[model samples]
Target: MRIEVNGTPRDIAAATVADALSELGWGEARVATALNGDFLPAASRPMQALRDGDRLEVLAPMQGG
Candidate 1:
């Protein structure tokens, strides 16, 4: 399926958000995810379904002060 990730087009073979994360190498990283402009909690990622042309935003915390 082709979806937009952080504004970039990406093709993935994942059925769910959790699967996508793993496919994108973000499985073990702590990050915030939003699908189609809706925020998705971590616990719900495993059940969150993704579709073609969906927009996914992934943000990881940055610490530097």
Candidate 2:
């Protein structure tokens, strides 16, 4: 499947959000995820189904001001 991740095009073979994250190499890292401009909670990731051309944003915490 093809999707835009963090504004870049990526080819991912995943059926769910959790699988996608893992495929992206996130692997248990602390981060936030949004799909199609909507925020998704951590608990919902495993069951969230993704479709073609979906926009996914994975954000990590930023420190220092």
Write model 2 residue lDDT over 1-65, tens digit each, in one string: 99999999999999888999999999699999999999999899999999999999999999999
lDDT of 1 by residue, 17-57 (tens): 99999999999999999999999999999999999999999
Give the runs in model 1 whose Cα sits over 4 Å from its true position.
none
What TM-scores do the predictions have?
0.97, 0.96
Off by over 4 Å in 2: none
- TM-score computed on alpha carbons, candidate 1: 0.97
Error of 2 at 20 (Å): 0.5
Determine the C-alpha RMSD for candidate 2 after optimal superposition of all C-alphas.
0.6
**Maximum-lDDT candidate:** 1
Model 1 pairs in collision: none
Q: Whole-model lDDT, candidate 1?
A: 0.97
